[model samples]
Structure formats: structure tokens, C-alpha cells
Target: MRLWLLLLLLFACPAYASEPAVDTLPPELVRLRDEGRLTVRALWAWKLVPAATATAAMELRAMGLDLIGADRAQLAAWVREAEEGTAAFSPAQREVLSGLLAMMDSGDAAASADMLPADAPAAAALPVPGVVDAVPAAPDTVDTAPPAPDVADAAPPLPDVAEAAPSVPGAASGPAMYRCGAARTGVSDASGPAGPPVELWKLKVGDGPCTPPVVLDGLACFGSVDGHLYAVDVATGALKWKFFAEDWVDQPPAMAGGTVFFGNVVGDRSGDRHFFALDAATGSEKWRFKSLYYGVNSSPAMVDGAICFGAGKHVYSADPQTGDAKWSLETSDTVGTPAVSDGTAFFAHANRLTAVELGADAEKWTFRAGANITTCPAVSDGLVVFGSDDFNIHAVDVQTGVEKWKFGTGLIHHPAAVHDGVVYAVSADNLHALDAATGTEKWKVNMQRAGLKAPVIDGDALILAAGNFLVSLDRASGQERWRFEAGGEITSPALAGGVAYFWSEDGHLYAVR
Candidate 1:
């Protein structure tokens, strides 16, 4: 045979005896190889070992993905990142490793091997502040001192350590949870400061938007888009401690019994499923709960000794300490953040609003709306109030699931705040105060916009966090009392001791008296 014919003849020698036929190979892998998903070098090496029988299933146990659907995705990600390692593998992991070793030891010049799951989140907390008596200088411990202002004349000096204030006063004895109290009512019993309030202090957290501040134990706590949950000194605007979550932290941290509960909402499936519990004072993790599908967008609502939240397609109640599931109610569609009132969790799933018992895991009732529900169900009195995509605010009887009233609005995006028999709903550019029982419009005021966030009832004023500005309207009459414009995108105010703490996208946490 000629040189080319001799090589072609050698390549054509297929089945020796014990090896599986080429037709018996996995069609999916063959399809992937044919589509050029695998690299040229990998395909060449795979061809070198014609009898290699390694699979990708047992090798990716650490990735925490749906293994049945993740072989291609995980392998692609690993190869794209140029994965390399010689670390010890678990027994099952070694099963594939042994296969690769046997091929490599067969004197083959190149043998292809899939990568392991190295991107999974470690069980231990990464890095945080105040976990011990002394923490060496690290990313979590930051010294945030502002520079002098730029001005033509003599500028005001920034907050100096020499003139530093005393310790941040503790927020009474009550540990603050998300959405005002455990009920998630968005109603604060205490009043914000009267008149044009003065700026007390501002501290830049991370280079991203922050979750609404949750005040507890002398620390003003919040999560940042920069993947950290920060606890700052309320009095001095100094960084106390921060917990690095390694993922976007959008939801507010709920605190109780010296533990902070928050969620990590990762858009990518790589790290999308953990509800974390960190120590309130130390920033150390207590426990983390996992879920399927998308990361946790719903904030945890602590109620009746169990932490309740709707994650993915299930309504889950976990123990506050161990992160163990107390009860889980599987739903047909996605679920929203739940508000607990009288042992019942009210959440919106697609076009229906459902109520499930927190303790018994029994579903009380489900109320179907005309359109997709856009907001969390706010429970007040005996009614559950929510907004639908059809531009109507529906108030359903909490016990019977019967629709009490359906009031039309221009464009209702956020849930209505119910306080003192009043349902405060915000439309595109209008704020309406209606009777909670009758759904009768009592007052309506037009503004530039109602803002993206839900309305917060602070004493007699209705705070419309109009994106970057704070509009305080008289809750009774819908008259504007004060409108404070922030430097960047601001969130709804979290009131602590007559002070309003606004988390701004400008990376500053503003404390206004």
C-alpha cells in the first residue's frame, strides 16, 4: 500500500473483539462531537481511545446541578474556563478518573478527560467580618472614609475619625425582620422625622444597588448587588462587618435571635440556589438552604417559629436555626415572596393568589385573578390585597378565597399597603387611598411617577420611593408633605428610631433624621 493508503487502512481497522461497536456509542455524544461543541484536540484524543467507556455523570456530583441535563453545559463551561487540577477525588469521582488513567497508561499520546465540578459553593462561609476576636485585613473588612468635597471656596470637612461619634445605638431590643415586621405589612408603626430632615451620615457600601436596610442590634444591615451583606454602624456610618455571599444579594436581610436570613439571587444556573442564615453580630453563616430552578427571588418571611418563603415552584418553611425544611408546598407555577398573617402564607403564583398554612403545610385556598399577579400578597384585617397585570387591585377574603372587591387602576405594579382600614395603592403616576373593606377611593394624588417599589406607610405619611426620590404624602388626604431627591436610585425607607435609612444605587446608605 502507498503511505496515504497504509494510514487510511490503519484508521479503518475498527472492532478487534471485546470493544463495543461504534454504532453502540452514545448518539448524544456523537451529536455533540459532530456539532463541534467539543474541541478538536478533545475529538482527536477521544478517537485515539476507541474503546474508552467513560461517562460524565459520576464526575459532576459536586456541581449541584440536575445531573441528568447538565453534562453538556458543565463540560462546556469547564472547557471554556481551561479547567486543570490533580486534586483528590471522591470514590465515585475516581471511577471516571480511573478510566482516564487506564487510557493514559496505555501509551496514548493524547487522551481526553472531562473536568470536575469545581464551581460549586463551599459549605463553609467564604470570608466575613467580626467572626472572631481578630480578623486580619481582608476584602470583607473595609475602611470607608470619604474624601474632601470639591468646591471653589473652602469645602466642608468630611467625617473625621478624631470627631467620630460614640457607639451606634442599638435598635431597641426588638430584632428587626424584613418588611417592617414578620407580617411583611410594609407599615411602620413609628413615624419618620418631621419636616425637612437633615442628612445624618452616608456610607458607600459596594459598587452596586443595595437591599433595603434591616436595622437590628446597633447594626444597619443590608445586602448589596456586589455579593455582600453589609452591617454598618448606624451612628458613625462606619463599616462594622460584611458577609461575602459570592452572588448578588438583592433581598433585605431578616434578623431574629442573633441570626440574619437572606437570599442569593444568581441569574446563572451556576450558583442560583441558597437561602443563607448568618450570625447577626459576627457575619458568620449559620446555615444555607438550597432549592431548584432559579435562585431565591422571594425574601424569607419568619413566621410561627419557621422561616417561610416561596422559592422556585414551592412554598417552603425552614427551621430558623438548622436550615432544615419544616414544610414545603409544591405549586404548579412560580411563587412570589410570601407574607404571613395568622399562621397562613399568602403568595402570588402566576395568575392565582394562594394561601397555605405555615405549620401544617395544608393549602387553605387559592384565589384566581383575571391576569398575572405582579406583587406579593399583603395581608391586613381579614382580606388579602394584591395587584394583577390587568391593572386592577384585588382584595380577597383571607378565609374564604372569595373576591371582595376589584378596583381598577391605571397601572398597578406594586402591592397595596393596608393600614388602619386604608388600602394605599400606587399607579403609574397616581397614589390612591381607598377603604380597605369597601375598596372605595378616598383620595388620589398625581405625581411624576409612583416609583417601582411598593408604598411604605410610615405613620401618617405615605412614602412613594419614586425610583430616586422620596415622596412623603399625607396618607389620609394624598397631599404631598415632602419630596426628597437622592443622589442616585433610592429604595423605600427602612425607619429605625424615627430615622429613615435609604439604600441608594450610588453605593451610599443615607441616614436622614
Candidate 2:
């Protein structure tokens, strides 16, 4: 068969003098070939037609080749072609294409140029004024230069460290700590030069317990069961402004961008609960959203321009400025307050703890705990720590959503507080300290009654709120340093500010010195 085919070819071929020179192709064709626009035949090539088509559109756009002019119909067609071509591109190329499409849609072509690869020849060919030039390029080669001298190495002139003014006594090392919850559970460790000492300026706003006062810009804002949210002067406890809601507001207000956001519980009615954003300075309503659930006990969390909170069995992300719904994530159980870090949101539900990616309503993982979770999950150092109704403290890996370790306490309602590589949790009858890395119990101190709230760590002390008394213990030894009895039963942890603030179940807010 081979011999026959060779004979046939020899007879069929015309007597050509010589082969044509490959370089004789037109300059335009040569340029296209150089830019990888030409295709070659291969035995098993998988042609990504969609990606190729998208690339063709993008390259044309990048080169400022306006094939569709300014006609709306032509532009639509061009965008459709580009969209179809996007499926063929690599993931990185697809991301660039998506960003460019977004910029074009927003009428910011100049901004789209910055998303172009620095090495892209098209970027150099087509310069975008102002916007694109600011993009920094990744270095392709490392520079080997002699190390610069350290600032400390040059002892040119010394500012006498010993002559410097002695540090102020009783001054905080950083910013004044801010706490959340009626018990003031969320306090920052930052302390600096002592501002005025934080005094408990009590105001009789209502008959019921007020939500934890949120301090922002010298104003302390809180909501009461009386259906009113009030902003009081932190210095004098004077009323600045107040806003009324349709129902009870139990959650702490979250302040962001000069606005305060909070949720309300439905009162004897059957419609959506209200979530509102108010002007920080005036206490006027900026925007309000109706949650499609019975009540929203969870406090709103603000990040970027979105407000996040849970109602019923769903967690929602709403625009803080416009009160528009960006996305909603449905959960198996009611969600608690959500804490965000590193583009991920951590939330607790009645039976599970869920971690979801921000900006995209996708679940990273759901950890099922055998009991209900009432407290918010705290995350730090790549670990998530929370307490369950099953009387256990669980620590899980943040990245893989896998359980690292769990310590059972055999009592419900213990809240977990994490600080300095230690998890402090309280059972109804004891305070337990566990290693944050391994969940091993460092020490356990028995109390006479249940501790419904977590211990607050301040400096070297661990403060515990046990039913009717406040106990401060040494952090390292768990030895009781001091104990104070209040007039009524105390269920929430106390806030530390030189002095401490706590609420009694009988509905009185107290400041203990």
C-alpha cells in the first residue's frame, strides 16, 4: 500500500521548479502571526473557540480598534461577543476580562487600563491618562544591592532617652477600649495617653435594660426595650437625640461611616422586623430595611459599605447607604452576630457555626455542634472559638473549617472569651481556662452559681460575672484576687474602664469602682 501511494503521488505531482519563500507573506499578516493571531494545524489540538473569540474582542478593544463605533446596537453586539469569548479564557484572563467589563460598564475606560497586565505590549501602545499609569508592575528580576544602613546604626545625634519626659502615670498605653453588649463585652486592648477617665454617666432612659452603649466620637448610643434608640453624651450622660422604633431594640448599634445600624424585635405583630441606619450626629433615620422574618435579635455588623445581620433563619447583607439588599444567606438555624476578618464572615447559629466568603454569598463550611449557640463566635490567629448550649467550648480551624479540639463543661450557657492565646469560658458553676492552641484545660475555679457571661480579660486579671457577684482572678493562676457583691443578680459580664459597668437582672445599670 505504501509503494502504491508513493507511485500515485509521483505521477500526480506537477513538475514545480522551486518552493515559494515563507517570508513573502504581507506585512499585516506577518504582524498578526507575530501577535499569535494565526492558528496552526495539529493532530490533537483542542481549540477554545469561546476564549479565542473573547480574546479577539478584548485585544481589539485594548488596541482601541473601535469596530462598533458608538452605536448602541453595535456596542451590545460587541459586549455579547466578548462575554461568549470569556468562557475560553484562563481563570486569570477571565478575572481581567471581568474587571475590564465592569469598568467599561461603569463608563470608566481609563480605569480598565490599570487592570491590564504590566507586560502587555498593548498597555505601552495605548496609554490611559491619569488612571492606568498608577498601576505598579511586578518586578521580573531581583536587584542585588548593598543593604542600606539602619537608622539606629547612625548615632549622629541622640535625643537623650533619659531626659525625655517621664511617661504619664495612669495613662492608658493606647486608645480607650470600647465594649459591646450591656455587659460591655467587646473592649479593645488599645491604650495610649489618658484621655478623661471614662465615667459612668447614667441616664434613666427607660424602665427596661438598655442595650450595650456604643461609643463613637464622644457619644454613647444605645437602644432600650422602650422602643427608643438614644444617643447620650459620654461626658455628662446628657441626651443628644433619640429615635423611636416600632418594636423593642435589643441589639447593640454598630457605627460605621458616620451612621449607626441596628435591628428591632417584632412586637405583637406579624410582619417584617425593621433594621435601620441612623445619622451618627443627629439620630435621624438615613435608611430602613424590612427584614422578612419575625425578629432580628442579632446586632448588625458593618464592613465596607454593607450592613450584615441575621433574622429568622437567614443572614442578609444590605447596603448601608441605600438599605438595598446585596445578598442573603440562608442558614439551618437562627444566626448570631457575625464577625468578619480577612474577607470571611464568622457566624453562629442555634445548631451550627457557619463561615461564608464576603462579597460572594457562598458557604465556606458549616460546623455542626450538638447544641444551640447563643453567643457570637470569636476568631483570632486562624482559629474560631465559640460556646455551645451543650456546655462545651469548641475550637475549629478557620481555613479548612475542621474541628481542632473541644472541651466539655457539662453545663450550658457558658460564653467563650479569647485573648492572648487563651480561651476563657464559664460554666454555670465554674470558670475554666483552656489553652487556645490545644483546648487543654489550664485551670478551673469553682463558683457558687452559674456564670451566664464570659470572663473579661483586662491586663493581668480575668473578671467573671457570677449571678449576683463580680469576681476578678489572676489570669495566670486563676486565683481569686477580689470579689464584689451587687444589689441584684448580674447576668452579663462587667466592662473594665479603671472602673467596671454591669447590668442587674432587676433592670438597673451600675458602675462599680
* Full-model lDDT, candidate 2: 0.55
Model 1, 79-148: lDDT tens digits are 3432343222223444443433333223222222232222212212233223332212222222343333
Per-candidate Cα lDDT values, in order, are: 0.63, 0.55
List of clashing residue pairs for candidate 2:
51-88, 54-85, 172-192, 173-191, 173-192, 174-191, 174-192, 175-191, 179-186, 428-450
The residue-level lDDT of candidate 1 at 325 comes to 93
Candidate 1 to truth, TM = 0.67
Pull out the clashing pairs in model 1. Answer: none
C-alpha lDDT of residue 78 in model 2: 42
Each prediction's total of clashing residue pairs, residues at least 3 apart in sequence or on different chains, is: 0, 10
What is candidate 2's CA lDDT for residue 193?
A: 13
